[model samples]
Target chain A: DAGITQSPRHKVTETGTPVTLRCHQTENHRYMYWYRQDPGHGLRLIHYSYGVKDTDKGEVSDGYSVSRSKTEDFLLTLESATSSQTSVYFCAISDFGSGGPYEQYFGPGTRLTVT
Target chain B: SQQGEEDPQALSIQEGENATMNCSYKTSINNLQWYRQNSGRGLVHLILIRSNEREKHSGRLRVTLDTSKKSSSLLITASRAADTASYFCATSGEQFYFGTGTSLTVIP
Candidate 1:
């Protein structure tokens, strides 16, 4: 299970409002990722953290930002939620890096609705 | 867009039949991983095949990678109704990119 949890399994917020989704892990993995899944688009990476305080932007990372203050916690924030930003978000953790083929453990996920 | 493309997009087969799905990606990769997602749930890792490895097996799951073609295929043997879900292939390099996914429906 990798002991991963995501806060607010479901959320509904108005457009222009700010929303923050949290991901916590117990394994203290070196890599944490944020991804969004929408119909026809599958999963798109938003942002990822390689370590505490070390993060990088992903393919679809325009409106989102992430922070990893601790090895167990990674946060994703939407400065101003938009209708187009509504989607199911997922968090994943991996113990390895680009050096090898390592599998990732995923959290339950967060479904956000922007109205 | 580094995202890979999954073929067929959807598949259906009777229980006990073998099911296969293919994924194609661009650019080089360090490894390829397959995942399954049940409805309304997070993805579960199924298997991983490194760039140096051609094939790997985990239980009923078999994965093959062809770096020369930048493609990979996943085969599910002796499928069961519980195996019905969305399958995705992700390529890992400097970053990770996921395919659109193939939805498999196993009839009982």
Candidate 2:
């Protein structure tokens, strides 16, 4: 366990409603990431934060946005949820390591359903 | 996409049998990692192989990396019913990209 926790482990919402998922880490790692896993697509990064108030978009950032106001928390928000956005979302954290491999620790994941 | 591609989207084997999964990537990577996810759960890091290394073993799991071929393979010896899960390969460069994954079912 990486001291990582995600809120609302399972959620179901209407297509046009806004939904937010929260990831909190107690390890104080420098890097935190949000990813979505779906059939045939595997896991795709949605966004990541390198530091507090520092974040970047990922490969599939079209329908999602993220915020990291505090070092321990990273939040993913869907301004208007779409049925296509239904998937299992995971949060991971990793520390900055020098000269070698860095391993990421994952949370339990959030299963979202947009009806 | 820097995502690696995993061979044989699904696999089914009897307990005590060995299971092998392969992953192929396009770009150069610093390291390749394997993760296992049970149904509806988060992924657990299985093992990691650096680009310079050819093979590594952790208990019953063995990982082989072939940088020249830009590919890797994971072998689970004497697989058990508990080994049933979806396995994914991820490559790290500027960012980490994960493959489609192989769903393995070890029937006991």
Tens digit per residue, CA lDDT, model 2, B13-103:
9999999999999999889999999998899999988888999999999999999999999999999999999999999864689999999
Whole-model lDDT, model 2:
0.93
- Kept native contacts, fraction for each prediction: 0.80, 0.69
Whose DockQ is greatest here? Answer: 1
lDDT of 1 by residue, B4-105 (tens): 999879999999999999999998988999999999999999888899999999999999999999999999999999999999999987567999999999
Q: After aligning candidate 1 to the native by TM-score, how far in Å is the CA of B93 from where it should be? A: 1.6
In candidate 2, residue A21 scores what lDDT? 100
Estimate the TM-score of every prediction.
0.97, 0.97
Candidate 2, what DockQ?
Answer: 0.73
Segments of candidate 1 deviating more than 4 angstroms: none
lDDT, residue B43, model 1 = 95
Backbone clash total, candidate 2: 0
